[model samples]
Target: MLVNPHICPAETTVILHICPVEMLVNPPTALAEMSVSPLICPVKTSVSRLIALAEMSVTRHIWPVETLATRWSTVTPVQQRRSSTLAPVQQRRRSTLAPVQQRRRSTLAPVQQRHRSTFSPVQQRRRSALAPVHQRPCSTLAPVQQRC
Candidate 1:
């Protein structure tokens, strides 16, 4: 194969080979190849162009169409049913928890106020700094000594 000296230096050579059918199908692959590697590697322009074109043709047209039908069909009815049913159970659990959550909220406000008044400001700051965000620290910071 004659390597275009302007494109590929004499010291190294690169070759690409492609069938005629691939050239007709995708042209961008060939363009990409010319842009990407011809300067760095010593490849014949025609061959790289053809190879790139062929790759593009396969990627652009052939593979996706071949996959489109099969990929979607692979999801079984059982899996679909499971996913649909699973979503609502999570929603229902949240709805069910709402009333119990409201009850807890009503009871907790007065108790939290009682706690604030009972502890001094320094102790309140110390307790808050040590406490987990979700749970209050009892004045003594011990579960056994905890007040309601």
Candidate 2:
């Protein structure tokens, strides 16, 4: 992740898919029901909380946070929105194509890269005549200023 305060990834700030340990300790109100965890993460930048949960065994009910929601879901993913001076929606950007080391792809992150129009395959080069060079930043631009 870019770790930029002004550019928090919206995906992480939203509800994380995790079930409560209560599911393991007691029978469900409905058989095979999975309970959703309360809001552990709020909508804000620079606020990251690492959470821990018990492993699921004896049943295939529990798995990684990401998988649990997809496999079994009784509650909709909570989506909360609040105004933040930082991390504006238009300013927020995400990219999964980076790891933390040499010849490193960190710069390839969307944090500094500008919006690119359709062009030839990325297999060629990131910069081309149609896409041109990305010299401007990612802030909202006026129509006249948006050329490139």
Candidate 3:
């Protein structure tokens, strides 16, 4: 799967499916075929063009990062504003969550360590007891007979 961090997440899945082989062979023919295919819903002409461009870049073996970045930059101002607004909210969420996460980890670490320390010896003893059974001895007797 092609994952370009520059591209918005919503578009990434769709864009990833635009294969180089399809574009290199013939974008128009490929798009036309895809349009008529029962599986593919009719996409807007602009979206189809973008998919074609993305696929074309794959054929040229160009990294899609720059292309996606440029394309994203050309997105309407409304989308730009929406993204900009989301940035601070995301930052605020991170800033708020960081200390809580750190506190949780700090509290959990000691409990986990204690639990591990208490259980480890018992677990080791159980494993050691089982190990001999797992490593069957070269004996004529069956396991039950050997144990008995």
Candidate 4:
């Protein structure tokens, strides 16, 4: 990959054309606080006409379709939007949470659900069955079961 010496003299560079913060901001800004300050990160790759892009910054930000889908994939959305101008300027919790979510599971969901085992009538079986496993069974397990 050809690195641009003009942008920054580094192999990887992040050009932060940050908007003037409307909200009072300090370091370590949380997602909740970001609602006031619409921080968007727009990426430009392989664009030949760099000069025109400056004038067209308004149109680029006016459409979030470019970065919305990508941001959705990574962040645990606080309140997901179908349409928004500043799509990249979302309240991102974390994009890396995807792996953690996948690692967790879809297992225990139906487990805790009320079990009206074929034996019982609908009303009578409203009670959840004796849990096959406790909530966070690993924590409760004896030392032997917890072995690495």
List residue ranges in candidate 2 displaced over 4 A. 1-57, 64-75, 79-148
Candidate 2 local lDDT, 1-148, one digit each (tens): 2355357655653422222334445546423443322222242221432222122232345345446544454435441222233236535432222233422656665533543433335635655543633555655657677675
Model 4 poorest 10 in a row by lDDT: 14-23
Error of 4 at 59 (Å): 7.7
Rank the models by lDDT, top first. Answer: 3, 1, 4, 2
Candidate 2, position 13, lDDT: 39
Give the alpha carbon lDDT tens digit for every residue of 34-145 in model 1: 6778665656777799899999998889778655634564666765676677779989999999999999999999999998788878797888886665475456466665
RMSD value for candidate 4:
28.4
Tens-place lDDT digits, model 4, residues 37-92: 54332223324346577658867885674567545655435434443534544434
Q: Where in model 1 is the C-alpha error above 4 Å?
A: 1-74, 120-148
Local accuracy by lDDT, each model: 0.71, 0.41, 0.76, 0.51
Top candidate (TM-score): 3
- The RMSD (Cα, Å) of candidate 2 is 33.2
Give me the displacement of residue 61 in model 1, in angstroms: 29
User: Model 3: how far is 41 from its true place, Å?
Assistant: 22
